[model samples]
Target: MKSTGDSKETFWKEYEKLPDAIKEALFSEENFKIVSDICEANGITSDESKSKLMKYVGKTLMGKLPIKDFFVTLELEMDMETNKAKAISREIDRKIFSGLRIALNKIYSTNIAENKIVSDNKRNKDGTEIPMPSKNEYKDPYKEPLI
Candidate 1:
């Protein structure tokens, strides 16, 4: 198990190992514009929306947060409707997640060809495997109650 600082350092080291083109695409203005469009479409005028979106994007990129959790966070923290949040998540998946997946796959294949250790799972600082949230834990905000 590593401390938070150690884990962050390791993450940054791995991030730096990625190709320059991949890094550039990950932080490109197009991606930023997509986030801004989402905020603006949802009538979120506050700068906080952009800040929170970027924060979640960073966590998602680092594999510290799941996309589902990002949707939940956006719905809760930004006062967004569930459908709007889900649409935003889908847009992000289409625009950002696909590119990230391709880049990661390329990196993974290269690492494998070089016989480098590739971790299959992310763990907590205590060395425990990070568990996915149950459906009950992430109930849809707009879901109707059962009779």
Candidate 2:
């Protein structure tokens, strides 16, 4: 929700200028705000932000998809470098999003753990027990499972 830039074009343009290897490695990373915020916070030059984003995106992909499937699909669709590049770029998008969601989940868990510790000692307005966060770990533990 942070104001990352004046417009979205700046975001995509920043993304495109990255080296082909980096662009390819991003695995379709799309936490636009996360990328923009990191860039802004770290004072990374545009080029550096691009490279860092690609690296993080790679970190994202290392968990969700098979490297072999990624390349095989790229080759299956491509008769040319540009086409292969575009195809691979699109392919990684899904993984980038998946990775972002995974990160959010982890953050949610940590917050839950924090909450649980605070809530466990309190009671409902009706004077009922606030059960200890079902999970004995982390903040925000009393929050119901979002699933």
Candidate 3:
């Protein structure tokens, strides 16, 4: 089995290869709700407390914000003391990050499967198989159905 660091590296590699549309989907409002539900079920944060965290997380995932900024924002937005904000950040990272990684992997795997299917169906004029596109080639976005 891969170590946590190895798996995380692999995850980010795959994440970087995803189309922008799919990357956007990973941090969509629907996914935020899913993460919120997961966190709420685990008693880490109340519904009222999640919005700020979720927004920061989304920004972080999109590469638009730093996590340190998230901690500060969490403290200010939720009116928590500094230590409380740090504790909540740790809890959120522990509880929510794993689930988000799993969701991203699922999305990435589905995209690979779909791309393979599309590539497999393609053939030359002489009916010979053509190679799959390079990593930079992005097809249409595939939307996963919400459960």
Best by TM-score: 1
Q: Which residue runs of candidate 1 sit more than 4 Å off their true CA positions?
A: 1-11, 17-22, 104-147
Please tell me which model should have the higher lDDT, number 2 or number 3: 3
Instruction: Kindly list the per-residue Cα lDDT of model 3 for residues 2-97, writing each as its tens digit.
Output: 699896797688668665654765567666766576557545477656766676676555444444476787778767778767766776566555
Candidate 3 regions with alpha-carbon error over 4 angstroms: 1-48, 96-147
TM-score of 3: 0.38
lDDT of 3: 0.63
**Which regions of candidate 2 are displaced past 4 Å?**
1-29, 64-147
TM-score, prediction 1: 0.56
What lDDT would each prediction earn against the true structure?
0.75, 0.47, 0.63
Please give each candidate's TM-score: 0.56, 0.22, 0.38
